[model samples]
Structure formats: C-alpha cells, structure tokens
Target: MSLVNAANRFLPSDTPAAFVADAQRVAVRGERVITLSMRHAGARQVALRYELVGAADAPVVFVAGGISAHRHLAANADFPEKGWVDDLVGEGRALDPANRRLLSFDFLGADGKLDAPIDTADQADAIAVLLDLLGIEQLHGFVGYSYGALVGLQFAIRHAARLHRLVAVSGAHRAHPYAAAWRALQRRAVALGQLQCAEDHGLALARQFAMLSYRTPEEFGERFDAAPEVVNGRVRVAAEDYLDAAGAQYVSRTPVDAYLRLSESIDLHRVVPSAVAVPTVVVAVEGDRLVPLADLVSLVEGLGPRGSLRVLRSPYGHDAFLKETDRIDAILATALRTTGETA
Candidate 1:
C-alpha cells in the first residue's frame, strides 16, 4: 500500500497537517500554534525550513529521527500516536517544559521531495546553527532514535564540548549492510521516474516493510493472533489496525521527501573518533532488524570506557523506544543523572 492509498483509506478528506494540529495541541498548551519557518543554512548555502516548538532559557535537548522533519512519532499514530517526547513534555515527565527547553527540527537536506543529496554531517551542523539561533551555548544532551540516533552521533562527534551527553537508542555510529539494503529499497521506491508513484505505492510498501522490521514476531503474533474479521469487507486485526493507523497517521504529517533525506543520511553514517569526546550511551534493542545488536556493540566498544551501553529485551524491535517506556525512562533517568554529576 502506498502512503496515498493508506491516506485515502483512513483520511480521504483530511490533510497530514490535521494530524499535526492534533499532535501539536498534545505537545503545547493554549495559544501555542504550530510554528514553521525558514532558517539560513550556513554550511549548505540554502535556506532550509524547519518546524520548531518549546521555549528558551531551559535546559535544552535536540532531536533528529530518521528523515523526519520533527514529527516522526506522531506520524505513526497507532504505535505512538503522539510521540515519545510527548510523555517527557507532559506535566510530570523529566522534560517538563517548565524546566527544560526541548528542541525538535527538520534537518537541512534534499528538498521536501527527498530527491536531493543531503549529508548527515551537514544536517548535524545545521542543527548546531539552530542552537546558535536559540542562544544555547551548550545542550543538556543530544537524543535520538534510529536516524535521529545517527544525527546525535554526528553532533557528538562534530561538537563534543557543546553537548553534555549523547543518548542513542536503536542507533549506531555506522550503517550496517542490512540498514543499507533496506534504505536502498526505500530510496528506489521514492526515486521512481514519477514522483507520485514513489510517494504512493513505493514509499507505502517501504513503510510497511520498515514496520515489519521495527516489530518482533512475538509482538506481532501476540497482537495479531486473530485475523481481522471481514467487517464491511475489511479485515482489521489488532496488528493490521495498528500498522494502518500508524501509516494513515503519518501520511498526513510527514512528506515523502523528508523520509528519503533522513533515511539516506542514516544509511551513510561513519564515526570520527577524534571528534567525539563527550560521554555517550548507546541503547540497543534485542530485536532491531535494521541495526543488529553487533553493530551497536561495536559502537559501544569503539566509544571506550566513558561510553556505556545497555540493551532492552523488547519484541517490538526498534519501536521498543516508544512501546517500552518504563525501561526507557529508567535507563534515561539514570543516564541523565549520571551525566549531570560526571559531565
């Protein structure tokens, strides 16, 4: 199914912006309208636009996730609907806006259509510029998942002193063969001669495949054991409902081009040891199909003693970062506390 196909099925009359509206509401309170604007990309010489949220003078955290322009979690409404950050920003979460400044933005890259060449390092540097705009001299931490994790690694390497700690979940400093292969297909899907073809069927199938890898067999089986009874000729199992809901949700909030840019950059990551001096923590999932455990292990080993690693036993694959929040919270709280004292 293509993004268009899925969108037609669930939201034939609504736009992706509608989902963004609802999610933005969940993230902010009264009078906080979703803000979008263009920022000068110092390194790339192009004025890259990004969507931004939160306020200043608070401890800051910068986020980048796979090829998304700051709304990947909300894009998939079924698994996460709102996003992992939503929990943190809520009244009682660690990132309560009352105390910390949370920054999430789209990286400079290929055009919104995902047809251009976007460098991961450049995107990281662009974010650094965004920090300068916000007058943040240093960050409490740089956090990421999947592609965002790759961006976080790049940030840690390029501006180590500027970041206190790096939290990478289901991400690696380097791209593995499996990730490369999967990314290639996604790219091919979006690169079809006709743009509509890529965005509709190609990217749709790509998302479906990516979703499969993001979850484990046990998780999928448990949730989808019973086939969806054909009601009105549509069989909607819990698992299928979950995926479609996620897909339909994102089709509106995220553009196909953004996904291409981020996914490609993630596929081409390489670490520069001399550039990475900050403390780092790499969070691995037991069943990440895109990035295997060995890849994360290598990242931890290469980061040395100050760099630590922990793995979560989740059958949800890479989606564990959202599905299994308790463990995520515990690990993050401990890591942040440890960094506050040590870094």
Candidate 2:
C-alpha cells in the first residue's frame, strides 16, 4: 500500500481524530507522507510529505524552494489552495505537469522539533531515498530557489549521475557573511524569546528582521517613504506595519524551532562548486541582498565550463524568483531544454 493509505493502520489508538482526519484528507489529495531512517548524525529519522504529479512515464523534475515551501507546487482538482510558486508551474505553465513528473517534499526540519542539525547533504540523501522508493532512477532536472538551491547543489555534487541538469535560483555555494550575520541575530532573537517564554513573539520578530534582508533598501524606500505617524502614542513608520504583518503571517505557519533549525542550516551550508559536475544554470537577481551577485559570479566561475549564469533585474530583491515569473519561466524553459553536456 502507498504510505498515505497505510499510515492510518499504524497510528496509535489514542491519536486524535482530527489528526487522522487530516491524514485521510491528504490521502484524498494524493499526497504521500513517508518516514525514512536517516543516515545523518543529528537526525535519526524524518517524515517527508511529498507529491508526485504528471504522467506515469514522464521525465521527473525535482522542484524545491526556500525553507518555507512545501511539496504542493500548484492547485489542482484535489488541492484548491494556490501553491507557493503557482505562477511558475501548473497547467500551461513552464513546468506543466501534463508532460513532466514534478517531485517536491517538505524539508526534514520543517516541523519545529527536529532537535538535531540538518545539513543540505541530509536533504539530498533523503531525495535520493524517495526516488529509489518510487523506482525513479534519474531526474531530468533539479530546479531550486533560495535554500532549495543550496540543497540542489549538494544533490548534484553527491549524486551527479542521478541528475541531468540543475537550475539554481537566488542561492550561492555558501552563505554570504553579511547574510549569515543577519541570520545569527534572528536566531538570537528567537533564543531571547524562548527565555522570555514568548517563543512565537521571538519568531515573529526574527521573521520581521528577515524581511529586511530578503528585500532591498530601494524597494523599501519606494514602498514606505510616507511620513511617520503617531499611533496610540507611539510613532510608527510605514515600513514597521509591513514588517509586522509579514512577521505575524510567518509565525502563523512556521514553528519557532523550525525557523531556528533552518536558519542555522543556511549558515552551515557549504559546497565546493567545482565538485558539481551536472550542467547548471545559475540565476541571480541584481539586488538580492541575501545572495550577493558577486558570490554567484564566483560560484559560476568555480564550476568552470559546467555552469552558466543568468542575471535578472528586479525590485523584489531576493524574492525575484517568486515575483519575476515571466523571466524565471523563460529561464526554466531554456535550462530544461538543454542536455546534460557542459556549457
């Protein structure tokens, strides 16, 4: 039986009815959650919730995004909620499921209680295991954005034979020191929140801070240049409200511990670009403060002739991959059309 169908049989008798009901609902949507024993040091096992959509004999393409993204890539008959990257995939989209098998899964430390550190290598290994389980021997391409790009690079480095091409968007071989510093402060904020017994508040604060780095000063200046106003006896800038809303929305979906683990994972991520033999298309946004253009240039150079760089200009900064859909879709089409041979 598929994992989703068999999951209920193993649930403890005392399991909440709501939990069981949710599982059944997911099964109806054709989403599968399977537990895998991990070989990594920090984690013993992880349950990966994944969705495979498309023709039975189509080429498989692995798609991933930042820490916040899950397996659902688009809305369909079973799933009504719009996907995180619905603009880039779906019917008549760049990665249309009608012709391609799209594979995506949740990150291992996404549940907020892993307690163990998760390396990108662990994520790569988990993908390999899932592919083995599904009897997929090779992937036509791996398209990853942000943190997912880091994991894609690791996958290409460790499992080069299993992949044909890679499209890494808004990510680099290592975290920029400035970006790492920002993440460190975010973690400290969460730690402070824990000590104060206000974990969610801390997480929200951290997310608010993250929004600053994820976007550019130019964008902020354009969007929040209005005069500060006094509200409830306190002066507030237009930007503060935007950041607060972003933080609150983030906290509603993300757990405090999950944020901490994934934030650390981004800083801990390191890969030797030269080791990646797969043909790679590196997409960098002009004003992405999180992943500097210089770092991406260095990454492409390090890969020698195996990698090609594509630069795009956007006011959205690091979020260009999510906002500049037309441009990203074009890049995806070109990259996916190429063979595994080095550029």
Candidate 3:
C-alpha cells in the first residue's frame, strides 16, 4: 500500500482532508510528520517527523547518526544543506540512493522539551511505527552510529523480524559506567547553567566537554601541541579555540533542554544482546573512550554465532565513525552486501 493509503487508515475520520492530501504530496522526499503512541510513560504520544529519499520502490534502509542528526541523510535538489553523513550515502556509496530508499528521522527529545527519559526501545518502536506508516514490512538494513547504533540494537531485539541486518557502529549494548559519568557531568553543567539563567553557557560548556570525550588526548596532542600564546593579555591554549568553536556551533543549533534530555538518554541506554536475533555487525574504534572496546566485545559474544566484530584503529576516538569515512564505507559495503543485494 502507498503511504497515503496507509495513513488514511490510521488517521482519524475527522482529520482534515488537506492534511491527508499533504501526506500524499510529500510521500517521497519531503518531510512528513505522523502522530504515534509511544511505548514508554514519559510521553504517551509523539509527533515524529521523517523523510524518505531515493527510488520509490527500492528496498528500504534506515540510517541514523548521533543525537544531533536529522532526517536529511543525503544532499539533493530538495535539500541543499550537506547531509550529516554525506560521505556514506551518495552515488555509488555504501547506502547509495540509486537502489536503496533511505529513511531517517529526528529523535523524540530533539526539541529538548521532554520531561522524562526515553529508552532506546522507545526509539525502536518509533521506527517500527514509521515503517508501518510507509507500508514497509521489513527493512533491508539498519545503519546506525553512536546513539543511533544503540537504537538499532534495541530495534533488532524488540522487532527482530522487522529487519534483515544490523550495523551498529561506535555503540554497545549498554552505556559504560565511565561514559555515563561523563554524560552526567555534562547534564549537571546544563542544569547549573539553567539555574543561573546561563543555559547557553552551560550548553556550550557541556558540548566542549563532550568534544573531549568524542575525541582523544592523542589527537589533541598531535593537533594542538603548539605553545600557548598570549592574546589580549591572557594566555590561550591552542585547543581552547577548537573546543570553543565546537561549543558555540552546538549552542547555536541545539537547545539546552534537548541537550540535557538526550545526554541523559544516552547514559540510560541499555539492551540485551542475546535478545537480538538478527544478523549483526558491530564496529568499534581502537581508542574510544565512551564505548569501551571490552563492552563491544562482550556484546558480539552475547549475540553468539549471529554476531561479528570489526575493529578500526584510529586516533579519532569515538568519532571515528564520522571521521574515518573510507574505512566505515568499506565496512558498510560488506555488511549491507550480506543480503545478496547491491546498491
């Protein structure tokens, strides 16, 4: 069934005719918002906004990134802005839109107004509802990075029959305690900033701290080993500028509430690897601080014979999935090919 027809079945009879017609109009590449009943108690219902790209009849592939990522997976005439992961989803890329339909969406707490924590399972259920609305019975593959990876694992466990393959990168079955502690600090910073009416300052500080966790000391040492310089009568370290820029950029686009909620969500994430029956490929970075290599190793082992691990040595730390494009592309190509299809 087409998305319009499927939506008509779920939408109330009193739903406006124009709203239903709008759904039909943007069925392919434009953004579509659907109201879904959530699985958790914090919020029972949510407005999920998603976008579909590529051939209308092609096999569906769900792609997601970190908390900040949105529905735009690739650049097109409709969306001129560069995609968050353009390196992995373009012509002849691993998730090429030529033969595979790409689906992506914003997280529930994206707007930062969430009052309660949302589990990874909640995100998985949201994706399941999206598939149903789009008339997609099963996904060809799910490619997730960071927080998205956690959601993919949950999806594979909760809706095992809804997907054929799972590719989880830079995320494990659960957040490591050390990683959760770092996130707690970030949340505390945001909270303190809110209390002082310095929400933006707190958010920037939180993001600056987050950047440190996403990368490594080795990388910082290599890139910012320059001698401290005095500017405006104050000594400034080389790394301070980079961290400041990252923090400022984050503050410009991310709301304080959203940052706190999502940061807490990441720390609260947990899943049972044994419950995930789908064929899985887990990717780990050599020096990742957030998701320790041991955690990922344990996750693959828990999956038994259905799981495999690929480790990449990189100085980029946890952000290797984003910075090491060529290597990630190669891994994705191999993982996505297991379905006996090419894109």
Q: What is the model-wide C-alpha lDDT for candidate 2? A: 0.81
The residue-level lDDT of candidate 3 at 198 comes to 95
lDDT (10s digit) by residue, model 2, range 92-196: 566877667788877777766587677888889889877776567999999999999999999999899999999999989999999999999999999999998
Q: What is the Cα-based TM-score of model 1? A: 0.74
- For 121-223, candidate 3 gives per-residue lDDT tens digits of 8889889987777667899999999999999999999899999999999999889999899999988888889898999899999999999999999999999
lDDT by residue (192-222, candidate 1, tens digit) is 7246554655666567667777778888777
Clashing pairs in 2: none
- Candidate 2 local lDDT, residue 115: 74
What is the alpha-carbon lDDT of model 3 when measured against the actual structure? 0.80
- lDDT per prediction? 0.63, 0.81, 0.80
Best by lDDT: 2
Clash-forming residue pairs, model 1:
2-200, 16-252, 64-148, 67-262, 77-81, 113-257, 114-257
Name the regions of candidate 1 deviating beyond 4 angstroms.
1-56, 69-84, 110-114, 192-198, 227-246, 273-275, 338-343
Predicted structure with the largest TM-score when compared to the true one: 3
| C-alpha TM-score for every candidate | 0.74, 0.88, 0.89
